[model samples]
Target: MSWAAGEFSQEEDRYSEVLRRQWGSPTLRGIYRDAYGADYPEEADPFGFVTRTDLARITELVAVEPGELLADLGCGRGGPGLVVARERGAVLRGVDVVEAAVTEARELARELGGEAEFAVGSFEQTGLADHSCAAVMSVDAFWMVWDKPGSLAELGRILRPGGRFVFTTWEPSYLDHRELLTEAGFEVLVHEHTPDWLHRQLAVYRGILGHRRRLADEMGQTAAATLIAEARETRSVLATTPRVLIAASTPA
Candidate 1:
């Protein structure tokens, strides 16, 4: 997710701080591992509800060929995109608004020895060439964009003809997500319910609440407090929100 429209710099600084603090918390990592089990990426640290299985599904659905460029929008820490690119033999271009996230993603790519690049960009202004990517993938970050139509249009602009855009996001019942995709000139291919997402996400939140002391020790009180607050805020809608994995494509 990105800032409401013009507040990009503020959100960038804020999220960069969050990433610097949150990524080093062993307690948080444990919470994710405990909740997700083998589904969590051991090397790529992604901040989203898309489990390892969800990522695998994304990898398969993207259908990227070897040497093709795959764009990962809102790519936090660059883990999921790196994993997908490696699995599919694709070059990765990861974009995030957070400078810290882009930094971490670049480091992760170097550590993993993958053909990838990370950039400071957002859903609305991805700095990529038109029709530059064979596929695009986003984890749980798509819903946070305030300018959904514009972002979708940006995705359409960057993706090649017939290229896939696969992502996981939560939608309230009132929103017509498919309509939005169609309006942006994409053909909705698959939109499936991810029933396990709620339970897994709740478990992570509960784990944070349960391990407050440890989290504070590792991530600092302010960061832990922020996580606790977000966990609490997220719990209110986890049940009502519908989690989905969607795959769409540009005109062939």
Candidate 2:
């Protein structure tokens, strides 16, 4: 990947340190891998809650052209970046805080023989040069950032004039949501709501867990207990959160 000097701000540096610490831990990584898979395969499912449709929509909005330089912020496992690079024949640069995730991404790129590169770093502080990239995108990963304004400003700096910047996030209606792009220098180009089927599927999953304890005799006690625990946690969080699909671009 092309490197730049002193790209991250002080606030970004602090957040990156915290994220790196958490994602770099072996225990936490294992837990995440167990729950989500090595590459988060569920993210690619259209009906899944944290699906890759957001990234797909961003690609459509950005209209990635052949040979374009594309930078993927918070590119977990590099799956979305690899797909975009392969389809558009773009040079892909991916950055993530998790070391193992970065390693997996690099391996995938190598196997696919695509012009892609991966790095272990935070999206808030990627050392990419100003006006160097043709497009910038992120997939379901911006929420962890502590300084939304600084992060978006950095994205603006790296993108060439008139270049596209697109990403997905939990909708503002979601709890713990932050306004990073508006505070920085991006304009929303398009917004697509998730389909009804997706909401229905999520509801089913939630409903099953709500009464999992009562149905423990029918389902295996171990499975029911585990499902109940997971459901309890997910329901507690989702009660106040709603995911969103968003695309934005830097001023031409």
Using TM-score as the measure, which candidate wins? 1
Error of 1 at 154 (Å): 0.8
* Model 1 lDDT tens row, 1-252: 222221221233344456667788877888989999988878677666767788789999999999999999989899999999999999999999888788888888999977999999999999999999999999877776778899999999999999999998877756778999999999999999875888898898899899999988998877777777667666766565678999999999
Q: lDDT values of the candidates? A: 0.83, 0.59
Best-fitting candidate, scored by lDDT = 1
The window of 10 residues in a row where model 1 has the poorest summed lDDT is 1-10
Clashing pairs in 2: none
Per-candidate RMSD vs. true structure? 3.7, 9.7
> How far off is model 2, as Cα RMSD?
9.7
